[model samples]
Target: MARRGKKKGRPVSGWLVFDKPVGMGSTEAVSKIKWLFKADKAGHAGTLDPLASGMLPIALGEATKTVPYVMDGAKIYRFTIAWGEARSTDDLEGHVTATSDRRPSEADIRALLPDYTGLIMQVPPQFSAVKIAGERAYDIAREGEIVDIPAREVEIGRLDLLDCPDENSAVFEIECGKGTYVRSLARDMGRDLGCHGHIAVLRRVEVDPFVADDLVTLEALEAAAAEARPQGEPGEDGRIVDTRPDKERFAALDALVVDTGAALDCLPEVAVSDDAAQRIRLGNPVIIRGRDAPVEASEAYATARGRLVAIGAVEAGMFKPKRVFTGR
Candidate 1:
């Protein structure tokens, strides 16, 4: 008699962090990784400019459902400012709009840097993706029409002067929350010192739970891809049978994909018994046993049919359904 068999399932879902390479858009990288892993879904948590590189988190499969949770996490970057010149895009990508003949001392820049260390209003660059009138501001700027963008509040938690390479150049590290623009920060720094400034180089060192040392280069990824191919697979165009599988393809995929549980780290967890799990699964909230004392009445109850169905944690123990994961 033939042996009984079980159905095979898809790969486990998880989050992957990539040290994003320069010159590639975040969406493009996500697409390539999706193909490599043959995953049904994927998304990046944050957007990095083409000229910037570093910590990009990619959510895969069920983890893609957690994109919004991590979208507002803090980011840290190390960038250099090219003093004495300002650019249209606020970086090296655009044409120079102004230049300064004088250079300020390190002490002058240091004193000025403190002014930008807290919350302030920053005007989004005209050549930015910020939408105005249902179109990208950059698109409108490219059409030769000047765009008047209003300033928005963003917090700069920390701004430390790392080094001054020369009188015309300085490097710094910044830790800021969502929507803070380092490019604009550099521009403002220059203006305060009585000199024009533009970002010469910028690298994100960290974003929330991710760090810089964990990034892999595109070259390394390509090499790994070359080594992971199956043996004896026919080579393209009758070339040597180089069947080494492309590990980088999967590596890139792995870097951006995250597990659903990992993605929900921000939320408080409440362990449910088998009965409670069943009730919650069936759209009914069961009263939870052994819950802590209630502090905030609003968060203490999960209602069903005008009655308290489940007792939730008062302050931080409230059972908020982030994303429901039903296995991989």
Candidate 2:
């Protein structure tokens, strides 16, 4: 048998709350972090457009398993809708599809808000990630083809007018559930208010258990990596080789990591014994004890000795592992 090759990067795991700047794609940001941290595996919980800037939760190593939880959480976005013109992509990134000399009054915009609130059917923009016959909508749109993207239900918890920066732009803050498209909101609002609209600026401020304040900028991460003193001595070749990410080498970088369990904070936690944790880690169900323990929970996580064991459900006083965790 042939010997397997060693993995390229360190087995680092945690959520890096990145404050992604506009013009940097989410995939590029994740790739940058993976390189700077030298992590073995990395993924982001949500995708932020290059034109959008805000809290982007990135998962490294085992933390990737918890991404779905973060994705399903409610998100808050502060967006500025530029009235008088609708774009092909429904944002400033696309070509102008329609134009209107009329702009909406604050009262008119707020009056339309009531209709958008709660659950409503929404059509994603033509330039979007939605798949059409296995092809992305945006890809087709780039080829000068407009496909009819189906309308689906999305929950808008609240929509508030923050300010009218000017007659051409209106700033709004929206609290929405998963899959809500801010660009669509801008487009729809513009149409309903008798003025064409598109997104001028979009900033995501919150995802459950994460806020913009928790974010570490990419520049800061790079600067920390540059400033980190090499903790290893030079080899016979006079080159430092021990570049593992530990407190001694990249303490500043490592300190920015949020635990994987933190992403599951929105889910109810089921406390289990060390013995139960061991069983859970082995993919076995164990009896969950505690008067406070829920008799049943659709989705929850198990913790033992203050460390994450697995993500699963509590049923009939038992914890059944769905996704197991190997690290804290």
Candidate 3:
């Protein structure tokens, strides 16, 4: 028998702002994009609940290195609180555990927003990805186990009651830091208002450096790929294959993928010399002189000739390459 050949994929790198549809897990979206682009490596900055639909920033190849920075940035979510039933998971997917006939007035909801804003303690829903004893809390819950997720501090920069569509539900937008759960906010708000509620429609509008407007749907990507292909041509096996060359296909895909540097836009940038860039790539720290002497008192990205060189902390005029994008 002939030995099997290795999988063929290119070392594609960049970020794809995916407008993830409902009922699709983050992992599944990444896998589909990976196969679609034939990428050597891929990952997402944050995980969106399968029930939620919105911006899911996917990182391919070298872009994956910058995911942590994006993950730490603030997130914006616009969700609806259905104020009649409180579900076990605090979302539409879970079984209804309690019900109420009362619906809080618009004024009442506005008055309650202040309590959730700024720094507040939030207990994540039981049916969540939170870890407990080296296992997922949701997995434990599925096994008929009780999971008491602790109340952790999360920052909600802004929370506004956007619209109260009807007596059944009200829409709201929240801008929050990492670890804030929209479901918990809805559940807690309902309890405070003397009514039961759960997240009925949840959508993330923004994540760090990306906004909803930048999102590209999977269908759009598939269409672009189809457009890139020439009229069907026969292969050695006498089957029709994509006639577009690999370079053209990759170029078309690249047009949609955001450059890796865009992910570091929030970070202070330092443009280094070719010699300095070389030294940084070789695992050495170069001194930034004069105008570039003191970088911001935070992590910074160093680039050379408009290409990302290294991400590092610049302290006392020394530019150390913490993580270098060498091959790219």
Candidate 2 clash figure, as a count: 0
Candidate 3 global lDDT: 0.88
lDDT of 1 by residue, 239-259 (tens): 555343544435543543444
TM-score of each: 0.79, 0.93, 0.94
lDDT of 1 at 40: 68
Ranked by TM-score, the better of candidates 1 and 3 is: 3
What is the alpha-carbon RMSD of candidate 3 to the true structure? 2.0
**Local accuracy of candidate 3 as per-residue lDDT tens digits, 1-328:** 9999998677878899999999999999999998788888999988899999999999998899999988998999999999988898899999998999888998888888999999999999989999988889899888877898889999999999889889889999999999899999989999999898999999999998987668898888887767555458687988777666777756767788888988998888888889999999998998876674565446888888899999998887788778999646
Q: Write the per-residue lDDT of candidate 2 for residues 1-328, one digit (tens) a residue.
A: 9999986776778999999999999999999999888788999988898999998999998999999989999999999999999898888888888899998888898789899999999998888889999999989989998788999999999999999978999898999999999999998988889898999999999988897768898888988888564657999999887676465676777888998899888889998888888989999999888878978998899998778889998889888999999854
Candidate 3 deviant stretches above 4 angstroms: 1-5, 228-232, 239-245, 290-298
The best candidate in terms of lDDT: 2
Question: Candidate 3's error at 34, in angstroms?
Answer: 0.8
lDDT of each: 0.71, 0.89, 0.88
On lDDT, the stronger of 1 and 3 is: 3
Each model's total of backbone clashes: 20, 0, 0
Q: Model 1 compared with the native: what TM-score? A: 0.79
Clashing pairs in 2: none
Clashes counted in candidate 1 amount to 20
